[model samples]
Target: MKPGLELGNTAAITAKVTPDMYAQFEGQIVHRAYSTVSMVYHMEWAARQIILPYLEADEEGIGGGVTAKHVSPTAGGDTITATATVTGLKGRAVITAVEVHNGKQLVGTGEVTQYVLPRSEIEKKLASEQAK
Candidate 1:
């Protein structure tokens, strides 16, 4: 949970683009631009996998922040890969740097902030507030 703890640690996740994931805008041309490249979702999936293992069963995680830039466009049938590195930890929150790539090109890169909390504790607190 330190700044350098995640520096060299890396995890990779893969996602395949399918026709069902494509977006169809009304009156717009349905092209590769409308396809869900799978890179965007892959990045989030990798981040969660990297952070969730460190949490307890009763704990829940929320994405507090994300700074990402989509660089390239990928088409359907292409497989995207996402990698996440833990860069730092602030209290119960873990800061990570993520990158998504399609074959040889980088599709996206960014940082994510995730918070860890006990699920039961959070629900109980909400219930108490509602009862007040």
Candidate 2:
């Protein structure tokens, strides 16, 4: 966390839907629209961007938790705008409210929590695990 990190800080990103974002796998068509997994990833991307600039040089944001819903289908070639707003802070964690829209339609919404950790601490933990 850093000074000036507060509620209402927002970040938004836009991306055009593509074949890869659709719910097709193994050449099987489960659906012909944006997937819930894609919505979660895009939502996290927007939330992370909002929290990054406030982190210290030694700190990195990691995904903590996310609860999301896919409410509507987004066709390929349609552009979606994902937005995140900081709503709360718990110690070193940031709580963000996220939403996705395709033009005037609401496609998805969620709450995401991101934890800021020292990069060195993560590497140290990995090294300790590897040593076992």
Candidate 3:
């Protein structure tokens, strides 16, 4: 990690809802609206943007956890935005509060937790998992 990451830092991502983002299970579409899974991915991406500028060449940020609640449905072609704000930082952990919206309506909210680790450490962990 490099310098300059702080609390209250923010980032956002805007996307238009599409059929691919619809609720589905095992390749079967369950609903033709935006899915919780897609919302969570956007939330994580927004959080990742906050750390990108601060990471060193040898450091990588990994998803630690995510908690989300889908409050409303958004149909295909509706534009949605996900924003993340840094809420806490402890040691190598970065915690962010995230919100998803379709225009003025709140669609979902969540928390994203990320851990900064050495790139070598991450690669070693991946290798260990593969060997298992």
For lDDT, the strongest prediction is: 3
Q: lDDT tens string, model 1, 24-128?
A: 566454765414334545666788877765677778777778787888777777887889988887787877899888897988898877787788767887799
For candidate 2, the per-residue lDDT at 129 reads 100
lDDT of each: 0.72, 0.90, 0.95
The residue-by-residue lDDT of candidate 3 on 1-132, one tens digit each, is 788899999999999998999999999999999999999999999999999999999999999999999999999999999999999999999999999999969999999999999999999999999999
Off by over 4 Å in 2: 129-132
Candidate 3 whole-model C-alpha lDDT, 0 to 1: 0.95
TM-score of each: 0.77, 0.91, 0.97
- Model 3: how far residue 18 lies from native, Å: 0.8
Q: Write down the TM-score for model 2.
A: 0.91
Candidate 1 Cα lDDT to native:
0.72
For model 3, name the residue pairs that clash.
none
The best-first sequence of candidates by TM-score reads 3, 2, 1
Across 55-101, the per-residue lDDT of candidate 2 in tens digits comes to 89998888889999889889988999999999998888899999999
Error of 1 at 29 (Å): 6.9
**Given candidate 3, what's the lDDT at residue 21?**
97
